[model samples]
Target chain A: MERKNFLRTFALVAATGPMIIDGCKKDSATKSTTSTTGTTTSTTTSASSGCVVTPTETEGPYPYVGGEATNPLNRVDVTDGQTGVPLSITFLVVNTNDNCNVVSDARVDIWHCNKDGYYSGYANQPGLLGSKSYVGETWLRGYELSDSNGAAKFTTIYPGWYGGRATHIHIEVYVNSVMKKTSQVTFLETISDVVHVSTLYAAHGVNPVRNASDSVFGDSATDLANEIMTLVGSVSAGYAGTYTIGLAL
Target chain B: MYKAKIKLVYKQVIDASSETSFEKAIIHASYQEFLLKSQAYNAEGKFKTFSRMKANDGRANSLHYKLSFSVLHFIEQLDNKIPVIKDNLGNKLSFDTAAFELIESHIEDSSLHKVAINYQTETLTLIDFMGDYLLLTSADAKSNEPSETFVVKMQPGLSIMNYQEINQFAINNLQLETP
Candidate 1:
């Protein structure tokens, strides 16, 4: 998808977060379908302008540590029995050096917290539900090598919010055993409002930290524009998100 | 918002099974777990380990006769130009040559088989083959231990690539045992 499309989608969601929350306070029961349909474009456009190198974001305290060496969980379904809003995340890795051509065989490592904001493979994760340590647990963590189309897809649930950071999924791309990119894919609060306030995710309430309040994504407009995932689908049926990442390698 | 700065603290590791050798059997089991779950081989391809022996060093039967050489040889082959361990602050631990050489030589000279990890001090553990040798205590102690046995039976006609089966077949059928 084009970068402009993602930016437009982000802007729409940026406005919808407050609207959805305010409506909920007044019991308006506004349908999210009206806003969701606005961002769904019919035409597919070239992403040549989106070819600029993806901004380097923090690897966050919970990286796999060994890149692809230690992580053996190569599966697409990283849910690992945890329940939440299903998210199908697709990362299109392109080369900034080579006219934005797709780069195949790049190793992509992904990890995020569950609906309760608990990350696996950590000893301590304190949050709203409770303080629990998931040391050695590999749920919501896996690695996938990019295919012929430079696409590495993962089947995971929509990650919940943590204390300081926004709702985001951590991503690291390695080409030829070298880390080409380390960044994150953030979700729009409009979508988070629908998913977080649902029956499954209602306990956590609404994630107060939107993209603008996030430590990593809050840095700049271009940061969210470059890192925000373009999500399609809904709160009830689940969402499929596509993000284009440009690597200099 | 402030970044949640979490440093690495060493977790306890223990032997998971008595019957299974830590080297091949356990590694293969984990490799199979990856293959079965992912349905795709690693980008580096199938799990493999290589060992080399010098003529006078082994004398054919010694248990620990310079494993450091082979370990260092593998380390030198890594094409990674940068450190893999990256935290929020971007301070990293690179697996450069000099550090491994020092650690290997120190271990060999001191005649110590195991290294102690201080839980109090934050340390970023380097990605060594040793991580595969032991299961972590709390999280993996239950499932990863082979003695506690859970079966992952392959479904009939599942389109998994036959490379692993073919390799196993070669090992079992084509071997000439020396009496």
Candidate 2:
């Protein structure tokens, strides 16, 4: 398939938030805790070998482009399972480069599943009501432009999983008014287990498995698997994760 | 439209061979020719020009062009140049040295946005073209390295847009001569 077509298909899957959320919720429940710090050298067999730094040639300033302004796919009502207070996850976009040069005007598109293993905008799924599941609610998932040092912050609910993928959030980066790249960040399955412990397991008595058995969690080199930490029991309901990504322009 | 005054500086450094003198003379002559063309464009309502000047530094093997004008006018001039002088065609226009190094080609239309040419330690930098500025640094120097930082600060009247837009315009319109 052509690269553009491939991207279009992947984008469709990405826009379909409920399917992804369901996959994640199912996998997170049965997964075992894995190491968060070690590199995926053993698993990533097809990693790109050449590491030359080549400057990218500029294209047209592609203006007035339009797609879906926001996703209405999956909505997870976040509540502190223990205290019953609503939980809001604060996401901070951090630049991976050492310079910390904030990428101003860079757009960040983020989406994930809700707590009950249902997505917001999926139509075919009988589980989702199809009408307007959190469609107008921009609070859970939305887009934000990075500030001077390439930082963006959002308050959202902790995402849940569905069938066979780990608990992860998908992010798309647009630099200089063009969509440049996409990457998914995963919490350490152990950390995901902790989240499961706080919500599903703690409330309904369920335990999720490791990423190795998940259908979507394959040996793909492109997957940026890593561990991130949030305050377990803070005044802010302690549901948050920080993800750092480097964009090559 | 609000009137804005801005300055643009173009710089280039050449090699140090016996032919260097000949190269320098040709560069000076070409610089003059380029300036005359720019002035003609300005007169034709391509840009509103306050002044355009050139300077040469033999010690650095460098030549510089400084232009001051209104932002909107300069952009208008650039809009014309963008389609005419592509990278390939621009290369054919002739550099004094056959080995003339093109450090950077940042032209938007006929209005030269920023062009830097370097020969050895001698560096050429262009700044404050209409609303934006370009900076060139030695590849060897660290970010915190204590080197003479060439600074050309612009006045507050100019507006800065996204660099990507300018770069894109340059790439699409860039033409080089097919040898």
Query: lDDT: which candidate is best?
Result: 1
In the range B1-179, model 1's lDDT, one tens digit per residue, is 11111222221121222231222222233223322222121223332211111122333112121122112222222222222322234433222121111111111122212211112212122111132221111112112224321111122211112111123333334343312
TM-score of each: 0.47, 0.34
What is the per-residue lDDT of model 1 for residues A197-238, given as tens digits with 9 covering 90 to 100? 988889997888888868899889887888888999988899
Worst 10 residues of 2 chain A by lDDT: A62-71
DockQ for all models: 0.01, 0.01
| Model 1 spans with C-alpha error above 4 angstroms | A1-72, B1-20, B23-179
lDDT, candidate 2, B36-81, per-residue tens: 3233223233333222211121222221221111011212212122
**How close to the true structure is residue A154 of candidate 1, measured as C-alpha lDDT?**
93
Model 2 achieves a DockQ score of 0.01
Model 1 local distance difference test score: 0.52
**Residue A166 miss distance in model 2 (angstroms):** 1.3
Which of the numbered candidates is closest to the native, going by highest DockQ? Answer: 1
Residue B11 lDDT in model 1?
19
lDDT of each: 0.52, 0.37
